[model samples]
Target chain A: MLGPILETLIGGLLTGVLYSLVALGFVLIFKASGVFNFAQGVMVLFAALSVARLSEFFPMPIAIALAVVVMIALAYAIEFLVLRRLVNQEGIILFMATLGVTYFLEGFGQTVWGSDIYKIDLGMPKNPIFVLESVFPGGLLIDPSELIAALICAIMVVALAIFFQVTRVGRALRAVADDHQAAQSVGIPLNQIWLMVWAVAGIVALVAGMMWGAKLGVQFSLSLVALKALPVLILGGFTSIPGAIVGGLIIGAGEKLAEVVLGPVLIRMFDLAGGGIENWFAYVLALMFLLVRPQGLFGEKIIERV
Target chain B: MLYREAGQFKTSYSADQAIFSIAQDRWFVMIVLLLGFVGVPLVANQYLYTEVFIPVLILSIAAIGLNILTGYCGQVSLGTGGFMAVGAYAAYNLALRIPDMNFILVFALSGVVAMLVGVLFGLPSLRIKGFYLAVATLAAQFFLEWAFARVKWFTNYAPSGSVAVGKIELFGFAIDTPDRKYLFVLALVVVMALAAKNMVRGRLGRSWMAMRDMDIAAEIIGIRPLNAKLSAFAVSSFYIGVAGALWGFLRLGSWEPLAFDINRSFQVLFMIIIGGLGSILGSFLGAAFIILVPIFLNQLPHLLGIPLSTAAVSHIEFMVFGAMIVFFLIVEPNGFARLWAIAKEKLRLWPFPY
Candidate 1:
């Protein structure tokens, strides 16, 4: 029992890292533009589909490079067509516009790439390795893909942290996030910053899409992963990147544990057909967190003055 | 000149406060209603009723419900689908268990059940603000969806996790036909819409609008946040719930839990946003546009002599919807209803220039 639990915990933490990858894009956009981008998930699907299809005609590395270009192009298009027109709108309206983007991307991706399940082979090992053999009966088995994902996620987060702290563009991005008007007053080009931020978010979506597409196949449902990341966003504040990481880990671990351990107990207690509690478990947990701390675990404290 | 209301006069408070204040406005609405009730039934065939009128009517009610909350009360709820599901399930249970209950009462009771659940989920609104509250509502959506799917009791232990209702008989009239169903739904919608209009026109609606505009300011003006938010949730849920029941019973006839999923919620949200928030008429316009545009898009390949696959058409439909949403948000965030209002304003000053 302990061995399986330990295995699940470690596995969940790795999956949580992947979730954090997706949530990070949301944080980047929210921080820069104050837009709660519902399109991030669809953007992930779109990016993955682009790479998967482009790879059919080109080399893997070139496909990835082209996909990055595609994402940057998307950022420009969104900035020019949607974001430019929607400046100074209410947050909710901006949020709704992102939903529109989500719809368009879903259709556009499918139409351009076709809706079949496309494979994204990153050449990551699929085999599971066992560890702690002496401590556990069958040993704790772990997937190397997940381990690689975790490593990649760690590197990305570090790179992002450095970008935000040690670079001029990053400082500008932070300034824009802090106060749009003040940032503009200080000679920051709001349009350029928005374009840059959206481009960065698009790249993040590309990385996330590659990871998720390799794991789950590039399909329409890849976009639904956005729904999963939303709970993580709530656990970690919308504007905090590190908070996104921590929140993802907690939610991922809690959901897996509940699905594996408490699932059967509830199944027996309620005479349920089967255990799929993880679907709602993360959301309910986030909701509870909202009640206690609406700003999230690491969010800036909200001070409402009438 | 005909559209001008310059000569209209009101001698009493009732006349002044009439829903359609202008005499021309009153006449237009009366004519439209007459056409809807009498003209439509005679001309509309089965396909028209099933594929168009029924759905537009049902969704309009749901849109109105959502408008009441998001537009009027200023509380954005992504859980409208869940609240609708509650109503659908509640009505199903009531109708199934009690064989002799009136269909009208069953619908009302289901709305009430959805209202209670709405109030429960809405408790978080007081603590959470703006986007935070919006995200929190997803909890209700997912949880309710899970319950309806997982709990065998809700589905009456069917091998398949879907529920079906028998023919609805209201006072010896079997409402199994399409036109009959449309008429029943139209009558209910008219009544409910009037009630909704009155509610918004009264103090409750005023308080809701006040709260929506600025909650803190509304609270400072002595409107309790708890009461205002919860009441908005309750009323909105009740309206959405009835629409859900109508959707399940009248529209789909037999369905699964997937019928009222998050997609339905988003669809209704789009209706209100495109229709114009905070306007009852906008709900209907939004519903009509949402329902009709897709149908029209699907047929464009045939009509325009474009040789496109069904898949391609659907994809284009999605792109169009997305582009339209952004277009509307940019050009006119108030939606089609606002456009109509502007047209009316222009008409009121037609053939004359400053």
Candidate 2:
């Protein structure tokens, strides 16, 4: 029993890292622009589609590089076309604009790249390796793809932390996030910073898309991962990077454990057809957490002054 | 000018406080309502009733419901679909179990049931705000959707997990025909829309708007956040729930849980946004636009004699819808109702401009 539970926990944690990768894009865009970017999921799907389809013509490396360029162009286009005109609007309106972007990206990705599921092969090993054989009877089986995803997530987090700490552009980004007017008054170009942040977020979407597409095969449903990341944001706090990571891990693990453990009890109690509690478990957990700490675990404390 | 209201006068408080203060406005509304009730049934075909009018009217109720919460109360919700599902399923079960119950009472009871669910989900609004609140509402959406799908009792243990109703009889009149369904839906929608308009005009509506514009300020002004916010949720869900029942019973006639999915929530949200937030009339206009635009897009290629696959047309429709949303948000965030108001304003001026 312990071995099975431990194995599930480890598997959930690895999956949680992937969620963190997606949540990072949302956090980056939200922190910099104060816009809750609803299009992040579609952006992931779009990036993955771009890479997958482009690889059909070009070498893998060239396809990836082209995909990066495409993402950057998309970043610039969103900033110029959508965000630039809607300055000083309400957060909800900006959020709605992102929804518009989401629909556009979904249509555009499907139109440009045929609406069929495409696979990404990073040449990662397909077999699962067993670890701690002596401790458990059958040992714990782990997917190498998930491990690679975790490694990539870790590297990105470290790189982002260092960039924010040591680079001038990163400092400007932080200052812009703190206060838009004050940051602008101090000679930081708001447009440039927004473009940069969006571009970085686009790159993050690319990496997330690749990882997710490799794991599940690139399809329209890949966009639904955005819904999954939303609970992670609720748990982590919309504007905190580290909060996103921790929140993702907690949500991912909690949902999995609940689905495995509590799902059966509910199924038996209610005579449900099957156990699929993970569908809403993460959200309910985040909602409960929010009731206790509305600001989120690592979110900056909200101070409202009339 | 034809649109001018310069000569209209009110001698009493009731007249001054009337929903339509202008005589011309009153006359126009009367004409429109008369046409809707009497003129439409005379000349309309079955296709128009089934394909166009019924859906528009049903969705308008939902749009109004969402407008009351997200537009007036300033609470963002992504769970309109869930509340709607509650109404649909509630109506289904009530009609199934109590075969002798009046259809009207069944619909009302479904609204009441959905109201309770809405209030329960809305409890989180006190703790969270903005996008967080939106996500919390999504929890309600997913949970309710999942429950309706998983809990066999809700569907009456239908093997296919879908529910259907037999012929609906109200007051010994069989409402089996398309025109009858349209009239039934139209009557309910008109009553509900008027009720919503009145509710929003009164002190209750004021309290909701107060909470929406600024919650802290509204609290300072002696409006209880708990009462104001929960009431908005209750009223909004009540309206949406009835719409859902109408959608399930009158429009679709049969539906699975997918009938009121998250996409439905987004569709209603889009209606309010495109119609004009915080305006009752905007809900109708937005609903009409959202429903009509796709149909128009589907026909555009054919009209132009351009041969395009259905898939391509759908993709283009999506692109156009998305573009239109962004365009509307950028150009006129107030939506079509604002444009209509502007048109009215211009008409009042007529051939003269300052």
TM-score of each: 0.99, 0.99
lDDT digits (tens) for residues A91-161 of candidate 2: 98898899999988888889999899898988999999999999999999999889999999999999999
Q: Candidate 1: global Cα-lDDT?
A: 0.92
Relative to the unseen true structure, what is the C-alpha lDDT of residue A124 in candidate 2, on a scale of 0 to 100? 95
- Please write out the lDDT profile of model 2 over residues B1-354, one tens digit for every residue: 787788787889999889998877889999999999999999999988988899999999999999999999999999999999999999999999998788999999999999999999999999899899999999999999999999999999999999998778899999999999999999998899999999999999999999998899999989999999999999999999998998999999899999999999999999999999999999999999999988898889999999988888888889899998999999998888899999989988987764
Q: Give the residue spans of candidate 1 off by over 4 A.
A: none
Q: Which CAPRI quality tier does the interface of model 1 achieve? A: medium
Clashes in model 1: which pairs? none
Model 1 lDDT tens row, B287-327: 99999988988888899898988888889899888888888
Candidate 2 wrongly placed segments (more than 4 Å): none
lDDT of each: 0.92, 0.94
Worst 10 residues of 2 chain B by lDDT: B1-10
